[model samples]
Target: MACQVQLILAIFAALLAALPFLSLNSFPIRRLLYPTCRCFPGEPCWPSDESWDAFNKTLGGKLIKTVPIGAVCHTNQSFVPYDAAACAELQAHWNEADTHVSSPSSITAPFFADQSCDPFAPPSSPCSIGTYVQYTVRAAGASDYRATIEFAKSNNIRLTIRNSAHDYFGKVTGAGAIAIWTHHLKDINVFDYASKHYTGKAAKVGAGVSMSEISQALKQQGLLAVIGNAPTVGVAGGYTQGAGHGMIASRHGLAADQVLEWEVVTAGGELLTASPSKNQDLYWALSGGGGGTYGIVLSMTVKAHPDEPTATAFLQFNSEGISTDLFYETIATYLHNTLAITDAGVGSIFQLSSAYFAVVPILGLGKTKEKIDELVQPTIDALTSKNIPFSYESTQYNSFHDAYAATTVETPVAFGQLGGRLPPRSDIEFSTTSFTGALRTIAEKGGLISGLSFNVSRMPDVPNSVLPGWRRSTISLVTGLIWNNTDWNANLEAQRIISEEFIPEIDRVSQQAPSSYMNEAAAREPNWKSVFFGDNYPELLRIKKKYDPSGLFWARTAVGSDTWVEGSDKRLCRT
Candidate 1:
């Protein structure tokens, strides 16, 4: 007991000692110092194999040693019969699709983070252990999450919360760390949700539940959920954490806006409930401030809307025969008409490629098909005047599930990077020559556009942390670069251009200080705090300090994660 007290005192002293040298650009060394009070990995003080074994025993053999999922290619001995063909196929699968790698709760896609982990590097690079978590506790229940948090806290080790592994920013895995995988905690319950702050018919879903699972499950109850377009995304994970947006968001608001409460385990090793009334700060932080930062989410109760008939529009125009100038004018015209379309109760995802498409999911929900057509006539007129060939389809569905199933376009994963922006309404339809020019400049960048009806007339009854700009923004604009997976240089180049070139251009044309959707934005975005959370960032940081002062949960580019950066070793280092 004496020794334990002394140890605690020493640690506190060390932390205070490390604080004086700290600045926004520099992190305290104590942040990374392990149990032995060491400063470096090779100084004989790092956690040893014996220590790991003991830790494993404490968890009842739940500790998992890290292995490169792609190691089959390099090592054929001591495991299985060497199959070169099989190894090559595995690499191909890992390279091309986020779904394959993101499938395993512990297996994060390579490109999601900085791709700093050497294990997922090109074949030419020697295979080595990456910055990935050395051990993961496959948490099946809340008790497991609590235990992991306590263990990490006592040991002064970093903790990472992983659910679904679908984060575009790769918050799921961290090297030299122990992970709590919440993917198996898939309990979804339906009941009358009553809270001091809110009362409604709601579904309380475990942290691991995906958007598709929720959508399909709600379909059985004749209900609708405002979920991201991708079916594979985790509904209760980073999606909600980063203020989830979708085609139906204009009506129901963001997925985060749908939350009534959350069950969470904080860094203090206490399981708590966060809601509009209970633990309100944590609730605000979890609502839209960011994910993998506040605490490990056990489950979330969200308001459920009764399913309604949806008018779906699937329209496409070919790029051939139209001059580049005419195409630019067509895009400007489309932006010009967004105000009326958005006002008429519609939400859409527009693609600007060889064959441009605007797939409106909840189209003219309270109006007629003719009304929807009239709203879109200006753009159609421009296309027709240019003699542009186009295809069009309009139908009504009993549920959003049916509409999405019939009209959804699959976006296959590739070696790519994505950067997003929320374009102000004035840019969309102010109709001035400069505004038109700015819209053209933005569209000329040519990427997927997912936004509609940001002209919200009313705000949420209770104040929370969802980014302030989302209430006024007209479109959620995205610009990205997809490259050949086999060529790693091209992958690196794509990331460079996304941050250095494309994002700046988007910011310039929009004439804003750059705000982005946290989940879908670039990992290395400059001035990320205000850009992701806007005026809410400072309050969110206060909540983070209150809940996780030790900075136990760190996702790359997450709120309050500035003290550390990823090193070439794939390990996180003090800045």
Candidate 2:
């Protein structure tokens, strides 16, 4: 026994000696290596008094101050003052629970209102008004949903289901509201694999699943599906509402187009499912009417593709000595070439900046770069003949997820540390104009253009699926200036110039295209309804009225909030 103990001690000492090297090798591991807090382990975590005070001020009296009945509570005054008693209780409960629980990571810190604003604000924005809250929910299946609904109803509070907090219109979370962060609702279940309903296979994904997680899961199952980059964006929210586009759009269709069914909670507190055979109207509305305007989605059942061959190409172009005339010529030629290649199951996306340009093209349905080259070589030759300096690289993947991640660029937060500045504070404003005909003329005249194109091959084959107003045009383009300084007047002047002077110049040359992608929209569009929702406007408004009669879901740019609505809009009654 003495000899065995000595040997064990020697091995332990050796492992300890290697600890520093392991830490150095795995920096990400360090981020997850925080010491456990003192709060009761199994109970819900609570904010310190200082944290709560800061959060209360930021909310400006929007939250309920008292704890609800049967809910655990704690009061620590700062990050340093963790409630040991609360942590202990929670830890004990967690150990006894049969289900799996994610160990708290550093990324799960207090979410402050000020933190939200900071990312949305321009440079040097104030942080004094920022506040945060920390909350936790126990792990359960259907029972968890019952508890959540009951909690909200009993507390007289509204719940905002947030997965990634990546809502472009800011509907995922709100100031001073109790945020039910759903990132913990990570469950992925593969349903029937031979059902005609899904055209083969489908998966029911929990609301909190991220795009990256879904992609990895599908890959493991020898299947693929449409998803965006920015690994952290929620699958149910972003993909569901924005009509998700991907590299394979020319062949497969938008993300919403492929959804087989959805499980959602209406504003009236009813949990429902939307699909072709059930609640079809709700299914249509939820597809592209923009999320939060109808109901909160709990899970989504999406169509999946069997293992299939895919091809991708990345081409880079430098504008060093290229004249504005030549640049415009290149863009026109590229668009024309893209339209020509669609028949061959080909689609391309052009990413342009003031200094450089990159084009990503995808060929679906078991095609190859060699075949892609057969169709695209002419366009490539044309650009090269004009002395345009460019390079191209192409490869093939076994699935759609791999092809998408290879082509999609990471999205920078509009106002976060990643993107330089935030949206302006004063009356938030935006402008847009459409283009047509004279693509070359505008380019030669030095019109700045930033364009993105996706072939909508897999979109629902139904006629009315792509809203009427937006269907007239095939390509969508946006060009604008982001103002960072606090000179409100100057920023306004710049905005006017872009809207009236710059965009009109392009419109004059190209004629008026008259359509835009609702997801990448400008707030100042005169006929936003006709532009974004197209023929679906009336239907969306009806559903909005039915589900949210009180108009409690409206935020900065949420659907159905008539910028013109008088004081009739107010929070929903928790009764």
User: Judged by TM-score, which candidate is best?
Assistant: 1
Candidate 2: RMSD to truth: 18.1
* lDDT by residue for model 1 (1-575), tens: 98987787578567657887542112233333333321234433345678678877767777776655555555422323444576667766654435443433334445643343233444444444455665688777777877787766555455788776665676777656678877667777877877666676799899888777888888888877778777766788888888888777767778888898899988887889998878988988898888998888999989888877777666676556777666656766777677777766577667665345454543644445666677778877887887887767677676677776776544455445677787667656564345445444545555443444444434676666888777767777776766444567776776776777767766666645667777777766877888888888778888888898877788877878886766665566556
lDDT of 2 by residue, 79-136 (tens): 2223446545543443121111122111111121323222223323333212222232
Q: Please estimate how well model 2 matches the true structure, expressed as its whole-model Cα lDDT.
A: 0.52
Screening candidate 1 with a backbone cut-off below 3 angstroms (N, C-alpha, C), the clashing residue pairs are: 131-175, 132-175
Q: Alpha-carbon error at 321 in model 1, in Å?
A: 0.6
Q: What is the C-alpha RMSD of each candidate to the true structure, in Å?
A: 6.5, 18.1
- The alpha-carbon lDDT assigned to residue 550 of candidate 2 equals 51
TM-score of candidate 1 on Cα atoms, chains taken together: 0.86
**With candidate 2 superimposed using the best TM-score fit, by how many Å does residue 384's alpha carbon deviate from the native?**
2.2
How high is the CA lDDT of each candidate model?
A: 0.68, 0.52
